[model samples]
Target: MSLSAATLRSLKHHNYRLWAGADLVSVTGTWMQVLGVNWLILSKTGSAASVGLSLVLQALPTLLLGLWGGALADRLPSRPVVLATQVAHAVLAAVLASVAMSDPASMTPVYGLVLASGVVSAIGGPALGRFGAEVVPREDLPNALALGSVINSGGRILGMSLAGMLLPFTGAGGLFLLNAVSFFAVIASILAMRASEMHRLVHAGENSGSVRAGLAYVLRTPRLLVLLALALVLGSLGRNYQVTMAAMSAGPLDAGAGGYGLLSTVFAIGTVAGGVIAAGRPRLTIGLLLGAALLTSVAQSVSGLMPGMAAFAALILPIAAGAVIIDTTVGTRVQLDSPGDMRGRVIAVQGVVSAAAGAVGGPLLGWLCDELGPRLTLEAAGAATVAATLVAAAALARLSNVRLDRAVLLPVRGILRRAPAEQAAALP
Candidate 1:
């Protein structure tokens, strides 16, 4: 298939274009703020562990309220839910900026504001995800998801790169204020969308399923259970490159902030390329997901052993690329596999998997980087991801006789592999 055609199929819609364009701008700023938050703690405490703790605090809200947020998204329209959350985010960011400006030396304001923003994000994240699905038809949904990854990764590239450059000039407070301003673009896009064109999902009633129902939904679906397992393991262990990368840049590479930004940009580039390839897939398969995971896990494991900064950056490209495949496959599969009424809840479940990863993995990994060194930390993460992939593949093979062992051994089998129509039904 022509990659351009497949990628553009969804972009042809005017509403998506408007929403996506504005989203690009807003997402870029959000990343800037993310780097800002992490950098601020590093500058103040000079501890990677503190940076990890901030990540935990950000994810903690999702553990507490993310499911409820997804339930609310299912019950209400995504636009208003998203709009309300965006406004909340803007207010919190502005407050952080103000506090940062007044008390540049204080740690209290940073933690407080981060926790507050996390609370809003818990609600907004699912609603925002569901909004992307609503803008395109069922056929275009996969493409939109892949393209969204591209946009998100692109934002990381621009945001982090710019943050590295601007941190010296504007500081963390400036990033917060800019993120606050960026929300207006998304708000305007929401207001501008033609509601008549949206393919909104039909609900059973004003109220659909609860958080418990969402958990039950995933528990019952074997595919989702397997995919969520992958997400938790890979997302938690394999993907906290930020901490290791920062440490590597500062310690081994001796490249400092500028070097860290360069590494991030390259990683984002890999995701963009991977998203494009994933966008071209007409249908996704467990074979593809497992294959992608294994491939990336291997890259990650090898990355830890690289001798120098140059080789390290090159190896990370493939690792980051494979991450996009795993991410897109899991996200697209979970969304399409579930019924419309269950969409929001399912998305929320994915969030739970992510939160669990950060809540547990972030601090653990950060501390390891301090004690064990960045190299060993990356190697350990890679080994865990590899173990998770093989375990998930084996589970499917035992239950469905799907023969994924061959898929894991032969990298090329993944591209050629197609799943059984019913995914060998009766998986628990």
Candidate 2:
């Protein structure tokens, strides 16, 4: 089906437009930093383990403190929180850039700076995520979510491509400097937004509950719990395929850093396509989630078995498509299903679940690659993702009365009728 005016109606909102533009710029810088860090570690230590360790430092804080961050989002204006985080990030990027420039190629202080930057990211991620819900009208939440994905996918392509090309001249230090500068673009956009125009659903000191309340609410709701479980499996363990993809390209494909960048770009192309498709659709559905998850698992498996560069690139398209579909669907559904006061905490819980998965999955997959080889490790991870999909599907199926798609698309429309009041009421 083609995108019609009704499907694209969400663009009419001014705030969403502002968010889309800012996120596009900011996320591109984040992607550049990611690539630069990976390269920096590889150059310094010549070990995959160091690469994994850096990733761990970057992500471990999220797994550990995401819930607290979520609570903080609920207690304050998300825009201000985001603004503060961006400022801190910019400073950190500048520091790293300085360190990189002085040495041209240093490891010790670079990794330490990366670790410090990750601590900042851990604070930023939940605030950034929940901020979307506050930036646009509730009716446009799904559209905003889709647009966020579009911006992120596009950013990955832009940043990774630019980093690959610029690294020769700027080195890791220069890229870090560029990343620091990019944050101002986002900061300016955010500051330009009218405070009255911000669509915040929760004001300060509104939802006062112990963190346990958030946990209890999530557990009491089977559907939300199921979705979070799937996110953990796919986002964390299944995504390890990406790490392996880089390794395989550098090894079997003999593609080097440029080749790895190409794989990222290819995957991002599919992600962009998928985000566009999702934006033009009505709302999320359970069937769509299942289909996407299964497709992602199978596609990932296929990626593992590809023989050469062309084949690998071709296989990654479907895998990336499935990945974006799942991300957009889950992201939209979580916002739609949550109560206004509890939105931040719910989103935070989701973040924690996802971070936990990545924390465990990244190192696990990295270790497996070290032991079993990239090809076998990726193939096994894909199979495991498929099994997770099956389990998620079976669990969701039991909620037969729950109209999964409608719950996501028109959350205000009464799909919650199928859900128990206690499921929502249990929120702390």
Best by lDDT: 1
Model 1: residues >4 Å from true position, as ranges?
39-50, 168-171, 204-208, 246-261, 367-377, 398-401, 405-411, 414-428
lDDT of 2 by residue, 192-307 (tens): 77778777776435446446666777788888988888898998767655678778886768899989978877877888977776666556555566766776787777777888
Per-candidate Cα RMSD to the true structure, in Å, reads: 3.6, 5.9
Show pairs that collide, candidate 2.
285-405
Assess each prediction's global lDDT (C-alpha) against the native: 0.82, 0.75
Candidate 2 runs further than 4 Å off: 1-8, 44-48, 104-108, 204-207, 247-262, 302-312, 367-379, 402-428
Backbone clash pairs in model 2 (N, Cα, C under 3 Å; residues 3+ apart or in different chains), count = 1
Compared with the true structure, model 1 gives a TM-score of 0.88
Clashes of each: 0, 1
TM-score of each: 0.88, 0.84
